[model samples]
Target: MIFPDNRYRQLRAIQAEDFHTCFYCGCIATEFDFAPPKAHWQSYQYRQLSADNLQVPACKECVALLKPCTMGLVQQRREWVHTKIAAKYKKAIGVYLKWNEDELEELDFSLHHSIAAGLKLGEESHRRSNFQGFSHEIDGSKVADVLPAAMPIVLFDKQFDSLKDAILYVCKNYPITQPKLVERLAEQGNNIEAVVMEIQEEQEVAQFQRQLKIQSAAFAKKHNQSARFVSNEVERYLDKELAYSIAEALDLLYEERVKHYR
Candidate 1:
């Protein structure tokens, strides 16, 4: 999830309407209460790598949606570990605390915790605190990396939220082509490589589907199937890319076997 650090915003954005919706189920039920705030990183308070949490006022469906999100390979990366820690600290510790190098050191907390941890305090308060004393020490990094870094990120901003929505919602919506989608599917005890291969296979399947559509239309016209008329008309503009030479074979075929199929 793209947890926007409000510190990233150099300018204040007007929060005109409620945009905090259940990221997974697509429900905007702000009326739902935040249950006993789930603190994933509280145990790491003194740990070298404990970041703040990302608590949201989620309805039941939305909370359920997070189950899949909890499991990501991105969570396993070393960078992600420090990021989680940074995110947690960002949440639990406010901008007011100025660090002297001697007093504190920063590490990637998200990588340590393996997921974005939401602290006890909530959305509105999280925003106010996110910007109270912003720093921009890591301005050169990418937005995702910098969000949890010393750089400023506008936490829960609409644009950032939209990006988060796109990440989760796209993973949910596509569930196949998205790389994160495969990672989540693997975490659920599903076959990881198999899921990935399925995505790789999808292009072949789609090509076959189009091929069938075109071939069926041709056969229909020959045999006069009920839909042949419509198929022939549609065919005028369809099947424009089926041409190929004998020098190459389809992706899966051995040369001799390909000749048989041809």
Candidate 2:
């Protein structure tokens, strides 16, 4: 479902408060756009489709350019933004370096600490209570690192319909890296696959458990006894090894069924 009118107004207000210019091209923002192109909202179940989580101010140009963009393109844009910001800061630092060594050292230390503080504030800004309190304070220093970086854009040689496909591609191509960012991307890929596999396994196990429970209930009904009583009796009688053997046998039977059907 789409946002209601009142929620849309609220979202616009929030977007205006958070962003005055286009996030990508730095033009005066005409409207808010979803960073992940709202079109792909169906891909994420955990992320709430709200202003705070998804909205970013954009000019017409950026909106048009990015509306059809892939996740790889999005990652490239984000990294470009970070690289630009870092360059700007470094340039300012280079100007300061024209001073004596002592002054340069002081400025270097100050900038480092300031950036570190901004990073901390950006991280904490995810919390609703801290967002309003810290946003304005760190606005100047807040960079693309504030958001989760996408897996390396270079890995996407082919089109990907989802983030999972993009991540898997990256993992397959660049399995190891010494750079911290690449390492983090590799770890993220591993974690996503691990989590997805774990969830699938858990769901299959749950389905099997439910089927077993239903069978136990049916057996209990046949014997004119409570399901819980029958289940407990079965559990008591079926040792761990026996249960494992039964599961193995069931697996073989299912495999045979698949073979026969094929």
Candidate 3:
């Protein structure tokens, strides 16, 4: 049971039309959630910190996400809910970034239908995560919320509405896919060029390694050397820092083996 049970009241939107809108996501509000839950105000002084002691209308999902949150204000709860929503739907967000409606239309029926659902989910999650609450009043007096606005992000000499938009833009223009880019961004900070360069370098290294494996097998067979021997010699050279390139390492091993045979 809450201490200030009587003090807990529904936060009223100034406009009647905004009544059913979820204060966190602007979805059709199915229930209400108390910002700084009723149990939190253990003292009258603690309850006095919030001017309104607001209980904002929220969607069921938003309510569930915010259930464990212990924020002191509506704005904080909204921000927390947005962060959770973004994280929960990041894969869908990746789909949104990777493919657009026109591109989906060009796919085969089954593929289009499957991806289209993901794209729609991504779009809704993105929108809900960014929703700001409607204007509201506290005890018949309107007041401004202290909520901070979403800061626009600049990447690749282009300004985007948010980081999500920037990521989507990068996905469209670069060979890098959305998930890989997101992973690298977390690892490499927000430097778009650095992320792209690192991924490109990794791809090059992987390709070279694959080619080396095939070439080394052929080189071993031609030189009458067992593949294991060739591999062991190359590993020894690399471990000793004697050869940088696989070609150079293989050539050195072949020379040494030929001299031994002779």
Candidate 4:
């Protein structure tokens, strides 16, 4: 299903939290880009509504480049990409931190060349008249490379309970495969069954918290009080509930897949 206007706003908020730039290319992100591609979720198995975890803000150029890399390829190449991009980011950050204004301007061309060369994106990047806004190109690759390698990305400013849950969430919400999830978790040396257990516990906690909030909200409304007057406790609880709900949904999705496989 298409995301509602509020969901778009939620995506925008995520971008704003990340400084309103594409997480991969560091260019201004005008749209939400699903990492696994939303098209991956259109199959009969995954035909559920999309969730925010599968998305990251990305620029048009980066999106175009990434879309061609299928999920199978992504699973295979993710580690190499992460290692390379992390090294590049570390090196770039070191140079950036050490450079003064004059030094920065002097090295701008070379930095741009380095990014274009590294990613093999081509000469279009070089044709740009200015390099000032290009600093993020390096940073963007760094972020993109690490995403698949790292589990439990912070969304809406909260860490997911486990990498398994995060992967399952993406699979349920997007068109990703069970093997891809298994591969990612394996790369991290995590047992898929163990991770699922952890996710289950987290989901239960979230469900209990959500029920409490619902009851509290109902009570306030019954007393003719403003249900909108949410206390900080309620807000915090709600955020946790949301996080847990995503994990729970992922857990249910995974169970279905397991049954199908069996």
TM-score of 2: 0.26
**Per-residue lDDT of candidate 4, residues 1-262 (tens digit):** 3353322222332222456665544467766555345455444226553333245555665555555553422222233333334343443432322222333345568785664343332222311111112122222233231233324444335466643345556556534364554554455454544545555677778777686567546644554444444333345544656654433433443354333653
Question: Cα RMSD for candidate 2?
Answer: 20.6
Most accurate candidate by lDDT: 3
Candidate 2 at 203: error in angstroms? 0.8
Per-residue lDDT of candidate 2, residues 1-262 (tens digit): 3332221122232233445655554456686555444555554335543322245555675566555553423335444444444343442322222222333345567776664554344332212111111122122333333334333333325555433344445444543222222234345642444543444577677776686687667755654556776555454444444554333533443354333653
The 10 consecutive residues of candidate 3 with the worst lDDT sum are: 1-10
lDDT of 2 at 77: 43
Question: For residues 1-262, what per-residue lDDT tens digits would candidate 3 score against the true structure?
Answer: 2132356555667788887889899898887787667667665345466534676778899999998987768888888999999899988866765666878768999999989999999888988888877877665667654445666676656678866667777787778777778778767755766786676798887887687678778887787777777776777877778446787888777777755784
Per-candidate TM-scores read: 0.22, 0.26, 0.62, 0.25
TM-score winner between candidates 1 and 2:
2
Q: Give the poorly placed runs of model 2, Cα more than 4 Å off.
A: 1-190, 236-239, 242-262
Which ranges in model 1 have alpha carbons more than 4 Å from their true place? 1-14, 23-25, 31-39, 67-262
Candidate-wise lDDT, in order: 0.34, 0.43, 0.76, 0.43
